[model samples]
Target: MNASLFCMAIFSVTLNAVAQIALRKTMLTLGALPSSLITAFSFLTNLIGNFWFLGGMLCYAVSIGAWMIVLSKAEVSAAYPLLSIGYLITAAIGYFFLGEHVNTTRLIGIGIICIGIVVISRSA
Candidate 1:
């Protein structure tokens, strides 16, 4: 990937990571899902009103548009692995911004993923 393509890919990945985090945060606020049909409407209403949920969806929309541009210029084999960066990004945001825990094992796993992403990008 050239510089512009790489930038676009990273932008898409970042937006997607934000979306995932936002959606997860929204779910944390919303709690357990409603079981009954009657309660489902109320759940939907609450979800529709959630700022985090709306922001997440907006991120997803922009991410998809950016991803389509990336896909048009790059090979899927090269591009898809880039999405793994999302895991590291999400973990960092979760820990720093959301006060979520990041255990040693998860840190190790994230390190391994970073290494893999480097190797994969080099192969592209």
Candidate 2:
């Protein structure tokens, strides 16, 4: 891929990963959301009012636009696999920013994902 397209792909995936992390943090901040229909409605109302949650939604919209550009520049089959890069990004964010632990098995899984991405990129 050209540098511009590659950068956009990376940006798109980063936004995807970051949005998820932000949303998770937002939920954690909210704490102990209910599963019942009425309580869920109240939860949704509060969630929608939060700026961070809205920002996460906005990130998704922007990421989708970037992803479309990536699609235009590259094969969907190739571009889609690159989204796994988000898993790596999220895992790193969770580890460094959120104080989340990464076990050996998770590291190995991430390694396998990296290998698969390399294989897929070579195919393109």
Candidate 3:
């Protein structure tokens, strides 16, 4: 891949990771969901004061733009698999920031995803 293309891919992936974290943080603040639409909207309108969700939406917009740039230069098949990088990042963010635990089996799964990315990159 060209240097610019590689950077775009990485940026896209990283932005996606950040977005996931932000959304998670936002949902945490929002607490439990309401059953009715009116109640849900009321809660959301109130809870939307949370900065994290807004930030996540902004990050998602940036990520989509970057992803479009990447797709313009590369095959979708190649670029799409790159999204897995976001999962790896989200896993780390969840573990560290959210105090979530990853068991040995999940670690193995993450390792597999890492290996897959490496292989895909090499082949690309």
Show model 2 residue runs off by greater than 4 Å: none
**lDDT (Cα, tens digit) per residue for candidate 2, span 1-124:** 7778988999999999989988988888788888789799888888989877988899999999999999988999988998999989999999998999999999999999999999998888
Considering every candidate listed, which one attains the maximal lDDT?
Answer: 1
lDDT of 3 at 107: 84
Choose 1 or 3, whichever is better by TM-score: 1
Candidate ordering by TM-score (highest first): 1, 2, 3
Stretches of model 1 off by over 4 angstroms after superposition: none
- The superposed Cα distance between candidate 3 and the true structure at residue 106, in angstroms, equals 1.1
The lDDT values for all models are: 0.96, 0.91, 0.89
Model 2 clash pairs are none
User: Which candidate do you rate higher for lDDT, 1 or 3?
Assistant: 1
Candidate 2: Cα lDDT at 35: 75
